[model samples]
Target: MTYLDKFPTATLLVIALTLGLAPFVPEPHIWEKIKMLLAGTLARPVDIFDLLFHGFPWILLALKLTRQATRPN
Candidate 1:
């Protein structure tokens, strides 16, 4: 098992808080893109990239936690 498998909850929390919640002075680029998405704006190349970049960690962490929960102890 990798380090992520060993510490899925901690890993998820850190990623979620850092990438999803923490505010920046100018605000995060991903946050702006996410707002655009919510407002029904067309996605630009950079917006797509920003979404994927910020979203990948959450996707990975959720998958890890789901796998861990369903696995037999």
Candidate 2:
């Protein structure tokens, strides 16, 4: 998305590392959410929001990287 383009790669990386993978103790929150997701236990609204919240940065970063790579030089 163009919104992602507004943020520099460094910015997105920082957000991804921080917000995307927060609560690092006892493993990251995202990791737990992922496990819950796979186990079909992520039915709660809060859990869904948590997954989306922690996963946004990584998704944006991936989209940005994919776009950059596919762009014609």
Candidate 3:
């Protein structure tokens, strides 16, 4: 929405780097969740929630890019 339009790109990037790819030890949280998703092991409720939680910032960043590309307003 217009709210996201007003959201700063740098802030989104920071969020994407931080929460989107958190727990950068063994592997990024999002990366692990994605692997679980592809391996059909993401059926647990908490795993599902983890995916959504970590993916939210990236999702918003993607949505922002898509909106900017399609709607110049």
Off by over 4 Å in 1: 1-8, 20-32
TM-score of 3: 0.93
Candidate 2 residue 56 C-alpha distance from true site, Å: 0.4
lDDT of candidate 2 over 1-73, digit per residue (tens): 7776687999899999999989999899999999999999999999999999999999999999998899789
Q: List RMSD in Å for every model shown.
A: 3.2, 1.1, 1.0
Whole-model Cα lDDT of every candidate shown, in order? 0.73, 0.93, 0.95
TM-score against native, each model: 0.63, 0.93, 0.93
Q: Show model 3 residue runs off by greater than 4 Å.
A: none
User: Candidate 1, TM-score vs. the true structure?
Assistant: 0.63
Model 1 C-alpha lDDT per residue in residues 3-35, reported as the tens digit of each score: 667775886878876875445548775677678
lDDT, candidate 3, 1-73, per-residue tens: 9899999888998999999999999899999999999999999999999999999999999998888899956
* Prediction 3 global C-alpha lDDT: 0.95
- Candidate 1 residue pairs in clash (backbone atoms < 3 Å): none
How many clashing residue pairs are found in candidate 2? 0
Best by TM-score: 3
Backbone clashes, candidate 3? 0
| Candidate 1, RMSD to the unseen true structure | 3.2
TM-score of 2: 0.93
